[model samples]
Target: RHYGIVYDNLVAAMRAELPKTVRFVAGRVSAVEAGPERQRVSIIGQPDVTARLLVLATGMGDILRRDVGIERRFVHQRQSLTFGFNVRPAGASAFKHPALTYYGERVSDGIDYLNFFPAGGVTRANLFVFREHTDPWVKALRDRPRETLIETLPGLLKTFGDFEVIDRVSSWLTDITVAENCKRDGVVLIGDAYQTSCPAAGTGVSRLLTDVERLCMVHVPQWMASPGMAAAKIAAFYDDPMKQAMDERGLELANFRRSLTIDTDLRWRARRQVHFSRRRILHEIDKFSPSFAARLRGLKRPQVEAVT
Candidate 1:
């Protein structure tokens, strides 16, 4: 019911499907000049190029964004850490489970969860944690990933069967940010350029896709049918109802994940208990009365509303 694919492979597949008329210039962008009717781009070792509009997808790169006078407001600094690596059964040829979500066993660990899923013919492990990037434990995990994982997650070996990390560990530190002063003539920001999401929140791609759909299908045609691409024209896309709701939901989910994992308040402590208890109950119910469990799952539960 769930699936995973390599990010680069997905991009390559999409690139291959693009129309022949679409051109991709390979060079570092050095400067940008945006205006009411035209946008100019200057790339290193390349001739200047101009277009009617610019859709920037430069993820977290601030040079061009700053060149155009856009600023970033950090919602949360060093919000979370994500680690990725390939894994395979140690002595056996297969694993006990196809996919697994292992929740952190201790609060002091600051680990949110470890996910194991099949992608690109290999079992990939993605670990999400709420911890300082400079922490000694983080260094230890990178230096001796297999040992550190087994020692920290003792049940992982038993739950998923013995496995060995087969590749270099890759780590990323995420900061939740949103662009400011982005409503400008001849330019628009989408995905991480407009806003960054917590990887644990699982909303980055959704937000990006939503932006593309609304901009391309809803706003672009309307804007092109008229005259100059002014700031007023760009503001409509930023103020789109669906896009605003999705962006707000991303922030809400990002905060909820952090609080659920690390907050030691009385309310969260009780909520945490209820959360795990419900999951355990559901697992047990499904094992015996799957049809009844399906009905219970079909019942709408309360949404995770944002708190001030």
Candidate 2:
């Protein structure tokens, strides 16, 4: 079963594990000046500081990246909409399942999927849809979330039990983008600052963490062992095989999710039917011939070449 945790709580726990030597200066960054040997940061109301290398994990906001002449190329515009809200069992003590994923039954609904999971000591509902912001359903959903959800997803109540939404609804519109012209001196972009992922694909954090691992654990020490921090040094992290694969896979999965949810073409329709059927078949097979089912699954899995 899937589980969830509050983001702030997770961050706090991570912060507690940090070394005391690490100091955090809280200030708005006004500008950045990057060079081969040093990187200068200008804070709105604080003294300027310089570092050997600059790493940006600031997310999709691109003002800082733009300051360094880095531009983001849109892979998909307004790729998907994600809605978040808290829910509680209407008349009961608890829900039927602690975690559940409900897929869209009809293609016309433009709904991808809805996830109900435990988070922040409450049942959290996250709905992903592929539709325009101007769509009437978007407004109706914001205005009357519980009723609209039940109406849009008829099987929701029967499957997950009755629920009532609490607190305000939060929504995010994602645009798939990748940073371009990022091979610069003394600076590197990570996470959403480098590329934005579709929430539906569930690869955003995977790619972000991969960026951190490859840069810090692998490349940073190698770069620091030398003298100058040139564009060539920064390019090594970008050119890392693991980072490239994760970034490329994120985009591929994003496209796959969109096409799977909305495409009405014969190929996709057939694929979708086969997709569901294959899962059911594998489940039944696993119950009987477990070893055979495992072998079948192994055969269907994609092969990857070693990145050494």
Candidate 3:
């Protein structure tokens, strides 16, 4: 199945299977008023509810975190537009065989990465184009999404040839950071609300799921056992397990970002040489043993994989 389809289906399934015992209140959580025995949660919708413990499931709301004195590191940039295309039979032939093709320097500023994956025993293919995060030219045309996409299409066509436009999507602005810690007393943040990393490293989604699973399965259960035990357990969970995961993933993302940036002429030459060297090695490896790459990736898997 396509990754996008799989992701959508998984989300839909989760939303469909609501617990009968657990009442889900859909609204914005404005405030959390703590009391002696329970906590009062202020909801923007009609009536509010009170609970023994409150779980703030807000995702990536930096404004609220800042109001509570939690300092974030990443900067939120403007949103970007994504364009997709259907591969024409003739155009698909160019990418029938597995190959890496460089689209060109992005109209935004830096170079954009384009990749094509062929469908097995078919004339259909999938193409992905990574745009620059913050490009001056792209930002200038942000208000005109269609014009922005039209302007960008030429750069893609110049490298990949003819194809039919399938769908155009727009993503919200997000922040990226390397800081690991995202927890505090009486309140915990999950998903983008806490910390964020570069998407290129593929850590954001996995890390967010890890946070949710860990909180719900381990920390929440212990907290529910007794109010006296809640504080210590929360502290331990955030300090040990959560902190370690974030630290490791954050370091990996930081290293990757550092490797991509060029400060000097010598550094630029070194980066280009390294990039070519890695490409050549990968090409040779794929030619000899196709499954070796998969095995290498599997070796890096965590001991426990969390369910999202």
Worst 10 residues of 1 by lDDT: 299-308
Candidate 3 lDDT over 251-301, as tens digits, reads 455344334432235775576567556556766887778799546534543
Relative to the true structure, candidate 1 reaches a TM of 0.94
**Which candidate's TM-score is highest?**
1
Candidate 2 minimal-lDDT segment of 10 residues: 299-308
Model 3, clash count? 1
RMSD of each: 2.4, 3.4, 6.3
Local lDDT at 33 for model 3: 54
lDDT of each structure? 0.90, 0.88, 0.50
Give TM per candidate: 0.94, 0.91, 0.65
Q: Is candidate 1 or candidate 2 better by TM-score?
A: 1
Off by over 4 Å in 1: 289-295, 305-308
- Better model by lDDT, 1 or 3? 1
Off by over 4 Å in 3: 6-9, 34-37, 66-69, 73-109, 112-135, 140-161, 164-173, 177-184, 228-233, 261-272, 292-308
Best by lDDT: 1
Q: Order the candidates by TM-score, highest first — what do you get?
A: 1, 2, 3
Give per-residue lDDT, candidate 1, residue 206. Answer: 88
Kindly report which residue pairs in candidate 3 clash with one another: 60-193
